[model samples]
Target chain A: MSTSQAPLIPAPGDTRRRPLVVMRSVSKMFSSGTLALSDMSLTVEGGEFVSLLGPSGCGKSTALRIIAGLGDVSTGTIDWPSSRINSKGLPEGDISFVFQEPTLMPWQTVFGNVYLPLKLRGVSKSAAREEIMNTLATVGLADFADAYPRELSGGMKMRVSIARALVTKPKLLLMDEPFAALDEITRQKLNDDVLRLWRETGITVIFVTHSVFESAYLSNRIVVMKARPGRVHADFPLKTSMSRDAHYRTSEDYRQACEKVSNMLIDAIGGEEH
Target chain B: MSDHASAFVPPKTGFFARNRDTLLRTLIPICVVIFLVLLWQFIITVNSIPQYILPGPLAVANSLYNDWGTLSPALWVTTQITMQALALALIGGVGIAIFLVQSKWIETAFYPITVILQVTPIVAIAPLILIYAPTTQVALLICAFLVAFFPILSNMVQGLKSVDHNLLNLYDLYGASRWQTLLYLKLPSSLPYFMTGLRIGGGLALIAAVVAEFAAGSAGAGSGLAFRLLESQYRLNIPRLFAALVLLSLLGVVIFAITSFISWFFLHRWHESSLKREN
Candidate 1:
């Protein structure tokens, strides 16, 4: 009634076991002549929890944004082998993005915010009600469907943001430091919820973060990058502690993984990328 | 819409406590008005000032009652012109603002002209409008519209341009069309700014209409409140003049109240300005 339903996201999905996305020698240069990314190549397997670990100005967020088609790569192309998610109007399994901030429309209710992706895809509010409600329920915000974004607490707002992202049922979910703002406890809870959601959805997630502990805890594979024209310093696979329970966080192996990732990250920050 | 589901209004406290601030706000003004009126009445009675020289509040009220037949029609005329002009101003202002914001070149080309119209006094131009228009009412409406247009246009332009870039990017990331982005995002964001323009424009519209009538100098029949006020002044009917002034003032207040209510209604749900809180 307001306007035509917008295509919420461009979903180009693959049914194969091949890499979902491949970025070969991707580089990004700003208009002001600052190089954000320098020939960083990475391959993302479908349904993998891959963390882009880097400091500020390391272009981790920029890489995620480029994958989501929100930013342009100065050089090289991002290849989606199975689904060609071009930057245009089309209905596919949408690629959903969660920014550092919740990025919920303050004017909309929690329900309306969740309904946005579907609404953009030309789904009417009444038609998309069930999906939005289901997603909200999943995020434990079913009771807050009518509340405004302003009325929500920080963690609750982040949940709402996640709900909005999940409502589209995207094959790939890209998040840039989504829980970097909250307190440590809320962050831990949200991290567990994210892992749960990832297992449940089987969606490919490329999470960007600067924290060594968060990277160690969340991802089985971590891509460590360096600043001053960001380039990937190393990509290593870590042994998962199985479940992300409190016991896992307190486990000796978990501490070892964090320390190992922390040393690699410190080396990335201190060592030069050639 | 599930809006009603979340119509979670905060619980009202006791009548006296809940409205203590509002009550004080209203009570103090009323008390001051009463005291001033009483003091003026005493001064008039003590000095024995004639009604023609300075009609007291009672005399003004009496004039309102006795000359209701003469003044009501004039009051209606003034109201009709003011409202019509205001409505025209709203359409013109909002329309121009949208078009201007669509292209920077268009805004650069036309914005200065609006500023030119705004900076120039209406009084200096009203006589010219009266000379060009087919009727005195048309002239008044044109003047009022000219006066009311700039505020809505400028405020709306600022509002449309002031949208958060990240929100715009969010819409873009979802493949939202330009129209959908504007409708779902920019329009809602601009509503608060538009409300401010409406309130300012409403008062300016009335002022312009009155000034235009004074400039037109048209007598009899379709004469507005300002014309009646002038006529009363010319005839030394001070009580009738005060009565006309009172009606005009009341109309201005009603306009302001309507605009404020509209602002609150649209923004009470989410905006910081209109949201209700304990503090």
Candidate 2:
């Protein structure tokens, strides 16, 4: 299948001008002295789409959590470029996260769930309604503003979660296998949607996934990780010129990219067995 | 032709036929109630029993109508006490449950006291409470509150603690404050359990109020239903006594109905308790 290239329209915002997130040889060891991550280092330029690919118990989630400030690294420092510059040149308004489960507030309506971060940041609903609506529309959930999480389907619920993360418009978005629970067809559809959002919004995303195809399809660069004192295994760049479109899945180059990731994962898993 | 006709024919029994077993199961208790009532009326008529020994259903119904004016006021007094006590119990019980959830030391120290209060017979303590509690009404209220509060507090504390660990972790990831976690997640998650406790507590509160009144009758206030019950027994007004008993039973039923309604109202959409099966 011939790869259909997405029209390389210039993104309205230039995120490449700034270094959005920087991780400096971070390591995490639990109180039990079990090392989850060791000397991990990565830099996410603004608007880049990167994937952390690994088997179960790999520190992909740990890395994502560390970036979000939810988990502290036992032995290293992470410097996120804050949007606002203080007198000391410290960066701010840096990160947001999308958890595996939607983690939506069950009692809240879809609109309310999407509006939470803004509300936390002291933005009134009336003031942020336009941005909330625009984000909801971008995620194809414009009509579900009044529906509660229980009323939504799995895919729809995840869409709301994505919308919530994007509403903040943070420089860096950390997703920990947000679509892993979805069926293959739904997962693929959401992958396209997510890539489209990332392209349009120009937000740097560091997505964690166990699926090799998912990692290859969405990421410009894929960082393969190994388990048991998790460390970087391989970094692969997609040679396929296909952009974030459905045709990318049918492209021969896309299949080769997926196969390459699958081979690396098998070796990673094999090394764990040894 | 006969084979074809058989192929096209539908089964004679419908969906209700499948539920006939459940229908029979439901009718057994109802039939038993009717049979018992009939037997009591028969025994009273055949033995020519004195009204004081065993008043028939008709005699009770008649007395209820005749003394409706006097009995109605006493019933209102009992109902008012039950409602007030239950409201106070709900407030105190949920407050304490939240406190217990917030502090491990408080839970360890005071949980045993709550259990002790629950098991200690109100009958044993009602007289002492009446002596020390300044007013008889306040004593009765306290007794009722004590009886109703523990079940709610215990059930709610368990509910609050049993919130999904993953969901709590998600909140932590989002940097939600403790207050936000309680208001947005914990309280809503604990609601169904709280409703269950409230239902149990409602009936219990009514029982406690009546029992306390029986143990320590009206002090300065004229009299409640319990005093009327004693007065009827002393006067050999068997019918009036029967009327008071019926009123108490009805009051218990009313409390149960209200609590169940509130539970259904809140949980009917998302909860299993209020679900109705078409089949």
Candidate 3:
């Protein structure tokens, strides 16, 4: 938790690496009069494993949706490092969203589900077969390529979903509490698998989760949000080596990092404006 | 290779156990049918009912055999009308459903007309239709079409609307065109609903055909089963009337079976409705 070194929010010259995107005072107000988000700002660098940690009604999903261009922000500007991609990452070059549920087509086979994003882009299924299969192997679901979503266990279904997200090979991947519905064992296992996947693909992941342990474990950076017109409460960077594995999970440092993030979560839920 | 041969051995399955489930499923319905027929025969004989009032099962069977020559042509006519109406309904209904789902304005404007056609009793409209149409066959087809179209339309609409929002967003995120979404997502999603509608419409189509025939029987020399039914009724040919009714009911059963087979053929692999479960 404390290496006695750099601050959580790095300075502009932190590593001579520019953020992939920057959101300054982003806010969202629903038509139903629910101000879901308010003046929340964040900066995500490419290939970083980031988690948006928050409670149930804290608009964590809303933030992720806004990023994926599925929902619009009411105020504030989301700027990309380059103007090639739109503010919401539209025209669909470099973004994939994973919903809280698997969001797979029930009728589609595992291969079919993974092939969806590519298929939508007018790529023939035959042409996309290799990439889809390789992505399936990355998620450890190669054998289930022909299996339907309903035939799969919850974990397997989520694996297929992750494969679909990765099939597109987007620069940024957005996940919204994807493992919240899973059991503890499956979730922990998936956490490890996801980290492996991130390392292998070098895709930036902005995962939203309410679990402090999950956020601490999976992310290099954690952005904490609070409810009641959702806004950023804290943004902390964890000191984790890129090679962290099963051994790192049981270490005192990981426990301390979880403890620190857990306290910030309590503050967010308690309505303390830290 | 034989070091772990146990894993490769096929799991043992008992002959009776495997077939028992299917046997029971098939057997129970057949037994119930036999029991009902026997009970019907028992009641009729016990009440000393005459053949004119209520024919026994044997009498009906005989009537079926004796009247087969006279009845087969009428059966063919009825079958033709039922099939033509069903084909027309399938086309019109599915086409309208596709049209309805294309835009909210179009759906909102024309959906009520479909509802009106569905709710109005086909029997009441049959006479009016007969008066307007050039021939009785066209009127009969229209009646059946009106009766059968709504289920397909409504179910298809529900199917199209039932597409998961996440899947839709995924399509959008990929910049898939609207037509692409419909082709790959919406149409397949609606298949189960369309099948359900087809099954319901199948029986309704037959009923509508028969009902329209009854209405049109007096207007012309309509040789459909309903005309035979009416003629037998007037001449007091009770056995022939029973034979016609039996043929009509059997046609309904056949239509039901065909539609169900169609549904099972399409959905058995993926859909829960048609999946086989372990006992």
Candidate 4:
């Protein structure tokens, strides 16, 4: 944690890549009179793994929902400048969302659950079989294609969920605290799986999490958020060139990054009291 | 994922141990029925009751064998009415439920009418239908259909409305059309509830068919078992009356069994209500 051993990473002012999504002064107010977000602005590049790190009441989830077109922005515009818009005026198959829960249909088999997004778009089962199997294999669930959601463990169900999300090969993947319910071991394992998937597929990811260690480990960039009319408190890039595996987990750079992000998170929460 | 499946594999067991619950379920019911029949016969013999006042089980069995030629046609009539009513109820109830769930305005306007029909007893309305219908058969069919329709409609409506909110959002995110959502999501989610409705409606349909025939009391070669019961009472043929009563009870049991099998068939794979316990 000493200054002499601090990792030589890029500072927060870097913005050289083309933005895939741009949100300008976005504010969301719920019908229950809760201002979940206020004047939030963010720009995500095409292949960056960005984490929205915040506490429970922060509007990180609200921001993700707006980006996924699941919720309406009360007072701003979200522009997908680099993606194609479907007839519904949203990025149709260009974006995929993973909720906090598995949110799978309990009656469906793993194959069927992973095939849902494609099936909804009028793709036949036989036509999508290969891509579905390949995605399942990527998540290490190729052997569980016939198992029902009720038969699988919690982590396996989440793997099916991730498979469903990645089946479409979307440009932007939005994960809303998808690993929060998992135990420590399963969560760490999924964290590694998601990082590998992100790197291999080159999909821009906006992962929402409250865990500083998680944000520090998986993200190329981290957006720290504050609660009570949630807005961005800090936007910084974590430019570690080390491969994120067990070795990096025990390295001094990873420790220094987590310590830095946790202090910023504490400062963000501490500022809300005044 | 690799080690998780090992714990869930059920341990091997002998055939008897595996089927012990089912064997007990079937065996206990048969024993209780035999005991009740023997008890009934013993009471009759011990009291020296006349056959005219109380026929013994053997006398009733004899009547069943002797009167099969007469009772068979009536049984066919009752069976046809019950089945036709059930099939019609299944179609109409599910159709109306779909129509009502399409919009809040339609549901508000039409759901109350279904409720009213359900609350009015079929017996109270049978005479009115019998007078208005083209024939007595039509009247009986209408009675049974009315009795069976409500449960299916109510349960189907609830099932359709109970779709998970998260699943609905996922459907929307995928740009699924209205029909696609209903076909792929809502209908499948409603299967367990629909099976429950079918089981309840099956029994009610049989009861309504018999009770409606009793209200009609129209006698002829085509009359159901209910009419035979009344005729035997009038003619003082107690053994024949007991035979018809036994056949009616057996018909109820058969209907129950068939409906239960159907419920189990559709839901056994995934539904909690039908899955086997670990023990």
Candidate 5:
């Protein structure tokens, strides 16, 4: 909002679907005197995969956290315009967050970790058993329900984290560099899984990552952000359709998209350096 | 077997091969203990040490068997005091730890006093406690409790504070209430640290119980092994003294073993400290 940078790809405007949540001129200054974000405005529409791409120290994560209601904005407001708002006034179960780390409770089994969101809402284990199993199945971890977090591989643990996030069938999913710790092969597989899940569930995803290729591969819209009091520098949609598959990953169009996004990311960081 | 030969099936090993580690772990300690006892006996015999000064292992064992009726009651008394102090320490320590961890201000306000209580010698406090307490037993219990409480409180406070920041954020994102967060996340995550405290506190409780009784100098039929130890020394019954000392040592070991078992039972499933390594 501060920069007023127009979307490089023309905004679809009134023809676009309803915006699920809109952040208007939001700024966050932590008590530690770190200006994590300044005038970061974003509008995530229903059923769109939006990736917030940036360099290190960028406040993409801070912005995501604030939107998820895990952190309070020092200034401005986030409005859930059309999604169902809970009594807490914070969309409650309608939104789920996947952290950078798997963040599973080592003491809990995969099923228990996945059951946490419902459990917090007072749902009994027996009542939520089938739903928990189904979410685990969706993440390809149906047989690992009774396995503890310590027993899982990095990829598997991240799958459990995804299962936990999706267990509630949330309308909005916020992920903060969810696969940055993973190997390249695993990250690619998970990227495919996440795209498939988003396609299937029609959940609005705001994915945060520094990886240009990943953002290009997964997002319908990419918002390249600049660091040092982070704010949006460029917002654009892919010129191609959303039906991405393994073949599409190696396609000429996808390669061009990745190149464009990569150059934009470089410019975003380079501009800040000057 | 023939059909799967090309598939690289593992060879079946003998029982000893399978259990070499277990055998070594148990047997080495037993062998060392036996060797030490024999050396102690040999030293006493060679020196022709008087029973009043340094009783032989056999003499001490004889006294242990002969004075079982008297020694057993004293052992029971000491055991009861140690256990009661440990149990009370656990409850009070955990309760206060939870309350203190609620805020940084609360922890800063109260944690130093617990450290002070811990550092102040229980032996020095026992005399003052004995004069004011309702009975010698109560004074001993207080001293033991004071000694045992700090390790648990400090460890539990640390454990509660050390919860993964991301996990806490996840809990907040889920809108988990304070109680739900504490019960489901904080408590389970703190358990390994709590177990560490329990093991340390268990041994300290026994030491404090004995030291407090010694400092209080309470003597009677109801007195603990500490009193029996003092009485035996005063009467020049060195064998009985050695026997009582042995029982105390055994009690300490038993407390350690029980605490370790409890720690293992809870943590072996997931905690890194307790997990079995492949090697």
Candidate 6:
């Protein structure tokens, strides 16, 4: 189940070029005393797309929540180098989240959903209209600003969720299997769209998914996790340097990378059962 | 090949069939009302029932037109009492709902009393209320409010409590204040339920007002339609009694229609209830 040891903690005094997020010796124990994560640690570098790949009950989502500050670490600390840029000692707001469900406000229009983070910051719609439109355009939903979520297809709704996440122009984006519920075709299409957006904006992405092929296709590094007090079991660097496109799917290198991740996942699961 | 060709052909529907579908879907209830009226007219005419005992529809209509001089003023008084009671209920019920949501202890102490009011028969309490209250109008208003207030309070409380846990967490993450959460999330989420309670409460309040008037006889120098009904019945002026009953039913229908329309107007854009009807 284990691979070569990769130091989860970032080197101290190298904070200037260190990963944007650093989680060290983190653990989460629920009120029921179930240990979801035990001494789990990970560092996500700037402008990198990393996938937390694991089976069910692997606490991958919990790890992402700890990074997002949505969940508290019971034992250790999470350090964000980006927070040093803010001088007021206030917690920074340079992170966004996209959940598994679209989670759009049912009462709000698409445009209203995208404008929510800005609105929360007391930014007027008139002041941020250009940026809102530009964000919607990037998601190819410029014409759907007035549409309600009920009127949208599953894929379209996920697109709106992505647009809302990106509208704030955050440096870090945390997504929890945002396309897991969509059809395979739609999921693949969204995967391409998200990678394109990532490349263009240089925003660091921490995506959680159980799909080996998806991890290989979309991530620079796949952080493989094992269950039952979940912790990192492998950190595999995907070596397919081919540009992510339709041709990449047909390349021999893509299949080999996917196969490698799949074998690691099987071994991790097999070890857990014993 | 022949079967496949036939599969794509559309069937032709007759004019009557199309029209019948429309009428069955839309106008059948209206037709039933007309049919019932005609049947009632036939029964009264053929039975040779005396006008004082059983007035024909035409006779009641004539009496209603002739007595408009008196009937209109009584209608105005009833309408005023009903509206004032409803308005008071709206303000008090919503204020109480807000209090209840803020403090669980207040809800625990007061919610049972609201349930008692809802389940207790209004007819049993009206006379006691009338005897104790300073004025008959006040007594009637109190009765109406008693009947009307609980629905709005109960509905709004449920609505406020039904807010999504995730949404609340999102607000917390954004550092939104309690007031902001209530204003932006709780209030908007509760509107459809509140409106539903109002519509139901409006009709119930009218019934309470009329019944209270019936039980109290007449208040002050001004009498409402209930008094006229009593006056007609005692004198055996059956046509006029029938006329008053018809007017009362019409008033009930109008109140229900207007409240429903207002609910629809506000909620038509986002709510499923209105959307289902539109489709």
- The best candidate by lDDT is 5
Model 4 interface DockQ: 0.59
How good is the docking of model 3, by CAPRI class? Answer: medium
Which run of 10 residues does model 2 chain B get worst, by summed lDDT?
B217-226
Better of 1 and 4 by lDDT: 4
TM-score: model 2 vs. ground truth: 0.86
Q: Of the pair 1 and 4, which is ahead by TM-score?
A: 4
Query: Taking the tens digit of each residue's C-alpha lDDT, what string does model 3 give over B1-279?
Result: 677886786755898767988999999999999999999899999998898888888888998999898888889989999999889998998888989988899999999999998998888888899899987788889999999889988998999998989889888887778889989999898899999999999988999888888777643344789898988888888988999999999999999999999999988878888877768
| Cα lDDT listed for each candidate | 0.87, 0.84, 0.85, 0.90, 0.91, 0.83
Q: Indicate the DockQ of the complex predicted as candidate 1.
A: 0.55
Write candidate 4's Cα lDDT for A104-222 as tens digits: 98788999999999999889999999999999999999999998898899999999999999999998999999999999999999999998897677788999999999999999899
Runs of candidate 3 with Cα error greater than 4 angstroms are A1-16, A86-91, A272-274, B1-18, B31-49, B218-222, B276-279
lDDT winner, 4 or 6? 4
TM-score of each: 0.91, 0.86, 0.89, 0.92, 0.94, 0.86
* Model 4 regions lying over 4 Å from their true place: A1-16, B1-24
Rank the candidate models, highest DockQ first: 5, 4, 3, 1, 6, 2
lDDT tens string, model 1, B11-57? 77889988999999999999999999999999999999999999999
Query: List-wise, what DockQ does each model earn?
Result: 0.55, 0.28, 0.57, 0.59, 0.81, 0.36
Give the per-residue lDDT digits (tens) of candidate 6, residues A176-217: 998999999999999999988987787878999999888888
- Candidate 2 structure quality by residue, lDDT tens digits, A1-274: 2344332222345436466677889999988889999999887776668899998899899888777666578987877664663332334345677889988776578998898878766788899999999999999999999987878899999999999888878777889999999998999889989888877776778999998888888887788999998989888666566565777778887888889999998888888855
- Kindly report, for each predicted structure in the order presented, the TM-score of its chain A compared with the true chain A: 0.91, 0.90, 0.90, 0.93, 0.92, 0.91
Worst 10 residues of 4 chain A by lDDT: A1-10
lDDT of 4: 0.90
Root-mean-square deviation of every model = 7.9, 4.7, 4.9, 5.3, 4.6, 5.1
Could you give candidate 5's per-residue lDDT for residues B20-116 as a string of tens digits?
Answer: 9999999999999999999999999999988998999999999999999999999999999999999999999999999999999998899888888
Best by TM-score: 5
Error of 1 at B154 (Å): 1.6
> lDDT tens digits, residues B8-118, model 6?
857559887658878686787898888988888899989888898788888898999998887888888888888888888888888888889888888899888888988
